[model samples]
Each structure stands twice: as C-alpha cells, then as structure tokens.
Target: MLYIIQTTLTLGFVYSLVALALFISYRILDIADLTTDGCYVLGMAVSVTAAYYGHPIFGIFLAIIAGMAAGYCTAFLQTRMGVPSILAGIVTNTGLYTINLMVMGWSSNVALLKKETIFMLFKHLGIGGPWMDLAIVAVIVIGCMALLRYFLSTRLGLSIRATGDNKDMVAASSINPRFTITVGLVIANALTGLCGALVGQLQKSADINAGTGIVVIGLACLIIGETVMNGKKNMTRNILACLIGNIIYRFIYAIILQTRLIPIDFLKLVTALIVALAIASPSLKENFSLYARRRKESL
Candidate 1:
C-alpha cells in the first residue's frame, strides 16, 4: 500500500506536466495542437538517446530543445504555410515519428543499462532517503508550476493570452498574433518535453509508442482539474488545478485498479468515462444550483 501510494504520487507529478501543457494550448491559446503525442515521443527519444550516451543530465535539456523544435515546425506549417492548426499539428506529428525512430537508432525502444539517472544522483546525496523519487519529481512539478505562473504574468505571456482571447483585437493592438501563437505553442510543447524527459529518466526506458493517446489523457486531466477546482479565474488557481486534477485522477485510477473494481482490460473505458463526467461537471453543478434555488423559491 505504501508502494502504491508512492507510485501514484510520483506519476501524478510526472503526468501533470502534460496537463499543464494542455492548460496553455487548449485553455489559454485555444488551439487544439495535436502535435502533443509525437512531441512527447520526440522528447523521450531525445532524452533516452542522450542518457544512453552517458549524459543523463544533458539529456533533459536536449529533450526540451527538441520539443521546442517540434513546436516551431507545427507553428511554421500553421502560420507561414497557411495550414489549419489541427492539420499542421498532424503533419508535424506524422513527421516526428520518423525523426523519433532515427533518434532511437531506428529502433522501437531504448533502455538505460545501469545509467546514473537524476533520481539516483539525488538519492546519493542522502536527501529524502526512501522517498527520493517522490522528492525529485515533486520538486520539479512545483518548480514548473511556479515558473508557469510567473511566465503567464509577464508581458509576452499577456500577449499570448490576449491572442487566445481575441486575435483580432491583439492584431489591432500591434501585437502579432502569429508570433504570440508560435511562442505559446513553443512553450507549451517545451513543458511536454520536460515531462517526457523526466518520465524517461525515472523509468530508465523510452518507447516509440509510449506517447500513444497522450493528448486524450492530457485533455482528461485538464478538464478534470478545471472541474475539481472552483474559481479558476486566477492564474494561480488554474495552474494548481493541473496538479490537483492529476493527483486526484491518479488516486482514483490506482485505487480502482488495486482493489479490483475494474479489470485491467477496461482501464481505457474507465478513463473515457471519467473524462466524460468531468466535461459535464460544470453543467451538472449549474443545473443543481438552479434547482436548489427554484425549490427554495417554491418553499
């Protein structure tokens, strides 16, 4: 049970970065960038490849740079080539598969053979003792959350936010909506890359198909986060929501799986159901509140 709890917390922190990425792209930018899955794999491929070469620490930086490059490609196709946002992401993602394979030496997966991961390095420092993994990932997640909040408060970040809210108004205000969109996607995918890098190092392996359905899962986490928290009007609350939602989701899934409430084969079905309920939660809450008010009026 302790092991399960630790695993749940570690993964919740690792996966929340994806939710954070979606918070920027889907929520702030209003762009459905489908490049998420491929970019995730690209990050993993880059990180593991670097780690295999005995540069575990440098690998993370490379993964983030690779993710930024992927984002630039998608942005180029969308802004410069006049491609639709969704199609641009699809084209970039399809191309990333080949790039990922090349990075993995044309292999489907790569594993670290007794490499010194950041987790091990930190553990050697005798900090957090038995909870080293949890400690490292938790710190990274908190750092990212804080950085994202600060970034969103900056001038350029405001431009990106405005671009999402009203591209026309932003353009009229002398802000290049295209530029803001490009920067926004770049940052969002960078977070995705960081998440991928951390997960790869933690697991000591990377797979070509590891990012499959990641966008859906991220979306589920994002929607779930928004539903779980009230007054998400502030940047801080919304940012925290990503962490809170993933933790809650991980807890629910782990408990159900551990207790045999759901078969392993039906895990995907359960995820879909959770996502649906989360999507409808706001409406349900509103209706319930309305009903309560009407009942009081009648009384």
Candidate 2:
C-alpha cells in the first residue's frame, strides 16, 4: 500500500507538468494543440539519446529546445501559413513521428536501464532512499509551479491570457494576438517536453509509443482539476488545482489497479470513461436537478 501511494504520487507529480502544458494551450490559449503526443515522444527520444551519451542534464535542455522547435513549427503553420490551428498541430504531430524516429537513431525504443540519470545523481549525492524519487519529483513540480506563477504575472503573460479571453479585444489593445498565441504554445510545448524527459529518465526507458494519447490524458487531468476545484478564479488556485487533480487521478488509478477489478488492457478505456464523466459532470448535475425539480412539482 505504501509503495502504491508513493508510485502514484511520483507519477502524478511528473504528469502534472503535462497538465500544466495543456492548461496553457487549452485553458489559457484556447488552442487544442495536438502536437502534445509528438512533442512528448520527441522529448523522451532526445533525453534518452543524451543520457546514452553521458550528459543526462544536457539531455533535458536539448529536450526543451526540441519541444520549443516543434511548437514553433506548429505556430508558424497556424500563424504564418494560414493553416487552421488544429490542422497545424496535426501536421506537426505527424511530421514529428519521423523526426522522433530519426532522433532515436531510427529505432522505436531505447533503454536507459544502465545509464546514469538525474535521479541517479541524487542517489550518488547521498540522498538515496525509497523517498528519493518522490522527493525529486516534488522539487521539480514545485519549481515549475513557482516559475509558472511568476511568469504568468508578467506583462507578456497577461497578453497571453488576454488573447485567450478575447482575441479581438487583444488585437484592439495592440497586443498582437498572433505573437501571444505563438509564445503561449512555445512555452506550453516546452513544458510538455520537459515532462516527457523526466518521465523517460524516471522510468529508465524511452519508447516511441509512450506518447500515444498523452494529450487526452492531460486534458482529462485539466478537466478533473477544474471540476473538483470549481469556483476558484485565482491563478495560483487554478495551477495548484492542476497538480492536485493529477494526484487525485493517479491515486484513483492506483486503487483500481490494486483491486484488479479490470484487466490491464482496459486501463485506457477506464481513463476515457473517467474523463467523459468529468467533462459531462456539470451538465449531468444540471439535468439531474431539473428532473428532481419536475418530480417534486408533480408530487
């Protein structure tokens, strides 16, 4: 049970970065960037390759750069090439398949089981323990949250938020919605790549298929957070909600896995069902209330 809890928290914290990325693109920029799946694999590919060369730290930076580049391509397609936003993301994502394969030396998977990773660095520095993994993930998550909070308070961040709220109004204010959108996506995808890099190192392996359905998972985390933490308008609250929601989601998964009530193959389906419920919760509640009221009136 303790091990399960720790695993859940570690995974939740690591994946919260993905939720944060989607929060920026989906919640803040109002763009459903499908580049997430590709960028995630891109990050893992880059990170594992770097780690294979004995530069695990440098691998993280390279992953972020690669993610930013992917974001730029997506943004350019939408902003400069007249491609629809969704279509631009799809194009970039599709192209990234080849790019990610190339980055992995034309392989579908790479193993880092024998490699030294960022987590191993902590172990080497006399911080080794069962809690070491959780501690490392917690530090990273907190740092990201703090940095994001500070960044979102800046003038440029306000422009991004404003662009999401009302593109026409931002244009009227001379904020250049195109620029804001581009910047927002770049930052969002950078975070996504970072998440992938961390997960690759943490798991000590990188697979081409690891990023499949990542966007859906991130969106589900975002919706779950919003539903649970509803009625909060503060940015900090909202950001914290993302992390908390991820933890809650992972915890639920852990519990379910332990129960073995369902087979492993259906886990993705379970996630989809959870997301569906979270997405429809508000409407479901409203309808239930209406039905109750109607029945009461008849009584």
Q: Tens digits of per-residue lDDT for model 1 on 104-169? A: 999999999888877888677677877889988999889999988898989998888988888679
Clashes of each: 0, 0
Model 2: what TM-score? 0.94
For 1-299, candidate 2 gives per-residue lDDT tens digits of 89988899999999999999989998899999999999999999999989988999999999999999999999999999999999999999999999999999999998986899988887877865888999988998899999999999999999899999886798688898779899999998998999999999988888999998888888888888877888248899889888988998898778778887788678888788877887788899999999999999999
lDDT of 1 at 112: 93
Model 2, CA-based lDDT: 0.90
Against the true structure, what is each candidate's TM-score? 0.91, 0.94
Alpha-carbon shift of residue 13 in model 1 (angstroms): 0.9
Model 2: residue 149 alpha-carbon error in angstroms:
0.8
Q: List ranges where model 2 is wrong by over 4 Å.
A: 282-299
**Evaluated with TM-score, which candidate comes out highest?**
2
